[model samples]
Target: MAEDPGTALVDQAVGYALLAMAGLRADALARATPCRGWDLGTLCAHLAESLVILRETVTGTPAVRACRPGRDPVAACRTEALRLARAWPAGGDGARPLAAVAATEVAVHGWDIARSLGACRPMPDGLAERLLRAAPALVGGGRAGLFAPPVAWPPDAPPGERLLALLGRRPG
Candidate 1:
């Protein structure tokens, strides 16, 4: 992990989110992701929207408008990522958990995007570790059913795969 886990998380999340979307094509919008019931387009929109909402929650700002028509999910995500990075206070301890949420959303949804795109790129281990530490608090609180029950992973699996398993995502 980096010196500041929060900043590192945001950096990792934004980069991966963008990378995942870069692989998206119009023809693939209807493709299935690892996330059940959500297609590629729907997951991308959710990830983009989540970033903006998370930023507002952490920055004490009013909610911004949802991604409107004529705005692609990738573009919206990039814009919100930049805005969130700027609005986020430096060394704000209270916002650390929010950062974790932002990172987790990006990473998990990045996985969905990548899976749909057949990219199969490895997720950063450090980011996965941070998300794993934050998961119980974020998902166990009132978000119970937000994720399915955790699946088992082999002990020798990579860090990202293990983290996804803990988050109830079955990583192939």
Candidate 2:
């Protein structure tokens, strides 16, 4: 059977995140990331935590216990991503919304990881477009702690750049 669009989005986002994490070295964990005040290690830890939460939500199982990303964050993220992929349900209305949110979280944080490494990896065009379409709904009126104020971008900018700007990241 074909994969659900939502699930596909999550998968793609996870792929993007994993790719961004490919170059991460243990020595670089202390490097600063775009997400103000968060270091690379902290960001990776957050990503791992987010994936576990997404997995639990999708599987409808309460987490047995808190998950700690441990010493090797990259491995932790990979493990969590695998778990999420395996736990993702075949299809359900409830999964779509969670998927959208998960995709956005993973993709944006992936970008953050890349930027932290001084890489200019653009978010894939298709994924960025989809996330942009879902942004307003996912980030309704209150832009308090979750995100910074939206940054302005040229109308002709790439979808990835536009999406990054909308999410308050200064894309280059």
Candidate 3:
């Protein structure tokens, strides 16, 4: 059977929670990430805020109109992600439902925070397949330099590492 769209949101929740848990310690806040110049704290903040935005979108809340001023981004993201999951709705055809985008961000951004902090965490080999299958356009796409300079895997480089390089990130 084909995968349900809610699977994507679930994936995002998994990724989001994983990153938050693994990388949001006090030391992590002080650490910089590989996203050019984003500190881990700022990166998390951005992502958390983004999560709320995405949750609101999928939940059929009217466009936020404007971001509410001075809210805790992390709290907001966690709340929204939880809310989305608890209230999980049935998917109709063509529902965007926070699947690919969240997964991509969490996957990519998770590594970014790790590399910046000089900590090593494995990127799953399967991510390449998912990324390619879900959105080839993600390659050479986006605003550019979304992460640090892409890695160049020499022929001898591990396949997983090379694949990440192709996606515009240095392997962690």
Candidate 4:
């Protein structure tokens, strides 16, 4: 079967998120993250939930049973990420748009995880460029509670920085 671009994008996003999660320790779970008011643990939990949603969207199967409270957030995210990757390639025709949204969510939140760890990891330039093009439609308007107002960014900024700014993150 021909490789699906959407599946590839989701794979890349999950891989990047996993890299950001490397070396995370329980002691640092309380660290503040770029997502205002959310600590690292909370952000990891949200990431795990997002992964489950993405997997369910593609697989049409409930995966939320893995998200019990007190489960290690990173482990939960890893499990769901693996499941999502496995399901995405077989996600049928309706999964493309969902793939784009999932890719964006995972990649941006991956950046957030890195930032929380005081790292400056940049999203892959190609992935950032693709997501930047798709972001306006994905996050345009009605974003009051879900996202902060868009941060102003120079037109000439790198794609990763521009994408982050569009999603209301201040890219350093």
Candidate 5:
């Protein structure tokens, strides 16, 4: 079956994230990240679990597995991301939206992972821009606990950075 374009886009973003995560060392898993109280391992765990839940939502399936710490966090994420990208239903009202959110999560968390490692790789601008436009509704105007209050960014800031700000991440 042909993949949905949104799903494919999400897959691409996940691929980039997996690449970034592949370089992380075991010791680095305990390092703090931009996600407030979350360390690298915590962020990774969230990312993986979120993907699985979103996948189940999109696929109309009961979640059968729980995310747990793995020997290789990167590999665990890669596996879950692949499952999410592949498991999107052939047709569903929520599939595209779920795919988009999954894409945003992976893309934004990709930045979080990179930030924790002090890596300077850029988030995909197109995906960030798309998510930024959809985010207000998706996240209920940055609801409490889901996201921090939106940080102010200059109008002329880079699209990806601006998107990050909209999602409550301070872009450096």
Candidate 6:
């Protein structure tokens, strides 16, 4: 029904990884990103913690710490990318595999980071497009009424831009 939860999960994993790397080195900790006023470093740390949660979910294990904690957040995120590239954890009709979601997250967050750097590419196109298509449901079902602005999306914008615009970031 909803985007095979695994898909979203995996996408997020990938997205954060990309964000961590693609975001400007200086800006990675200072620039504002789509997640509102949170700087790049904070965003990366948040994403890193998120991945740890995903890893626990995928592994179906009981997690003590939600984030990697004290290690270099960026390096921890990069390590996740490497592992996720190798294999995604799967379950529930095989639709919400962790790897797939991780990939999607990586690509989109990469785009986000690129935008912050003023250097975004068009993406691989396919994955970004697919994420654009699914993001509404993924975002809407969970928290549409929670944080979206009173302003709606611009009618003619691309889906990625529209999605970012909705979240308070200028899209690439």
**Can you write out model 1's per-residue Cα lDDT over 48-119, one digit (the tens) per residue?**
788778878887888765578877766676677767766666677887777888788878887878878988
Q: How far off is residue 77 in model 6, in Å?
A: 1.9
Displacement of residue 65 (Cα, Å) in model 3 is 11
Tell me the TM-score of each prediction against the true structure. 0.87, 0.93, 0.68, 0.94, 0.87, 0.66
Give the residue spans of candidate 4 off by over 4 A.
none
Give the lowest summed-lDDT range of ten residues in model 6: 94-103
Assess candidate 2 and give its TM-score to the true structure: 0.93
**Which candidate ranks first by lDDT, i.e. highest?**
4
Name the weakest run of 10 consecutive residues (lDDT summed) in model 3.
62-71
lDDT per residue (tens digit) for residues 119-166 in model 5: 887776776677778777777854788887789999788778887888
Q: Alpha carbon lDDT of residue 115, candidate 6?
A: 62
Model 1 TM-score (2 dp) = 0.87
* Candidate 6 segments whose C-alpha is farther than 4 A from its true place: 1-28, 62-70, 90-105, 141-147, 150-156, 166-168
| Model 3 alpha-carbon drift over 4 Å, by segment | 1-13, 16-20, 62-90, 96-98, 139-142, 145-149, 154-163
Worst 10 residues of 2 by lDDT: 62-71
TM-score of 5: 0.87
Model 4, 13-96: lDDT tens per residue? 989988887867778889999899999888888888888877887878876655587798878877777778878855467898
Which has the better TM-score: candidate 2, or candidate 3?
2
Model 6 TM-score relative to the real fold: 0.66
lDDT of 4: 0.85
Q: Where does candidate 4 have its weakest 10-residue lDDT segment?
A: 61-70
Best by TM-score: 4
Q: Ten-residue segment with the worst summed lDDT in candidate 5?
A: 64-73
